[model samples]
Target: MKNLIAATYAPMHTDGSLNTDKIKDYSQFLTKNNVSGVFMNGSTGDFTSLTIDERKAITLAWSENKSKDLYLIDHVGDPSLKVAKELAQYASDKVDAIAAIAPFYFRLNSIDKLIDYCKEIAICAPNLPFYYYHIPVLSGAQLNMASFLEQAKDNIPNLAGIKFTNNDLIDYGHCKSKANSKYNILFGYDELFINSLPLGATGWVGSTYNHLAPLYYKIKELFENGNMEAAADLQSKAIKFVELLNSKGGFNGVGKGFMRVLGVDCGPSRFPHTTLSDSDYIEIKEALDGIGLKSWFSK
Candidate 1:
């Protein structure tokens, strides 16, 4: 799962039903843009808003749509151990890998508990590589991830690495520097991608990649070419893009809707995630075009 892995949106009908049918075009759109994989049903996929059946349907759709050009990393986390386990088992045969965040409802108070929780889920898919979805801001389990790398390294047999989604550079740096550099610490904060490049981050999984893979790939190219100034400038524009959509309603809703501007209509977001009017998208299109990010989308 190196390079860009888009944490994709759950395509839905306006009536809030899962539109799993869209995964084929979605997969092709991603591959066309050079995104290497899909991080299915993660935060950006609005997993929390979906029912277990719905999430499973989403997983099955992605699994069925699997291609040589795109890998699938299914996020199987759920507050219910049974549900998480079930999803993990379901993904075992379907996806290239599986991932789970700490159960967020009650919260795991200790790293030991997190390891136990992850281990249980991970064992269900022993054949598939597992990644701990470490997005503490959303999960509320802010245990030191460096310690997770140290502790979990030996515990979870299928553990491949961390889908690191926080802003703590110190901890991130420590995780990347883990002895032998075993894990695939997939940096998830899209805006901070350029910053992670210097630390040797190769794989990145995030929502914005669904919309701006070309832009980010270019950013990586610029950074790799020693053009720090241009990379930083593009990175700033990405932040601006998120902030701009965020101001309209919320970024997840607006940004997912922004996919239409990129030529793939992911349809409306689920409940609690505001859906925008067509006019809103028009205004967003104008705003993004004004900022010179129009060329980043797939034509």
Candidate 2:
């Protein structure tokens, strides 16, 4: 769990259907790239766009490839608590862990409401570790996470920790210190990877890990060797990777297409995400090469 975990993409066919068949190859690709685990049905996986059955199918597909090396975590968060519980139950035995975000449609106004929501869903998968996906920007549940952990520790039985996605380092620092430093607070803001290291972040979950696992490992290596300057330089290069893809379209859409360039054809993204053409990849590859990133791409 100290290694990078990839927030995977939902592979789709040309007709925009689930391509579960591709998941086996996708798993192998992640393993080859040295990604230690996967956060499936996550934001990067486009969980909102997928049906409950499709999300269940993804959990099942990834389960087949689950090994000691490649951990699997299913994001079963839906606006409907009933639906979230169902998905969590479905993934309980299949995945290594389960995570859920606060109800996005009707946001939880208070920390107590958020805790109650997590408690209900966490119980459905009582046997598995539960993680709160705290991406307030998207979920609109901007409650302080440190406070949530303090109160939630007594309420939720299997509360492992949080997937802290927000950029608020102050809140993150507080969350990290809660419960006498017991919770497994996985840092989610990838662009600020270096910012997290000084505060003692060992594990990470992000979309960029899918493309640049080696690059991140290099960044960590440089940082640990007391070379702050080189580490920051490499970190900038990683951010450039995100910015470059985001420039083409949204990072979620364009970044998925770049997987094909790495030899794992994840196919096109679903509706509302841009699908790149062969020419687009050609240009993308050339631009990335110009930025000195080609040599650092995941193997």
The CA lDDT of each predicted structure is: 0.90, 0.92
* Candidate achieving the largest lDDT: 2
Please count the clashing residue pairs in each candidate, in the order shown.
0, 0
lDDT of 2 by residue, 1-299 (tens): 56899999998887888888999899988999889999999999999999999999999999997877898989999999999999999998999899999998888899989999999999999999999999999999989999999899889989998999999999998888774657889999999999999988888999999999998998899889999998998899999999989999889999999999998888889879889899999999999999899899986
- State candidate 1's TM-score: 0.98
Structural similarity to truth (TM-score) of each candidate? 0.98, 0.98
lDDT of 1: 0.90
CA RMSD per model (angstroms): 1.0, 0.9
Give the lDDT of residue 279 in candidate 2: 99
* Sequence-dependent TM-score of model 2: 0.98
Model 1 ranges with Cα > 4 A deviation: none
Worst 10 residues of 2 by lDDT: 174-183
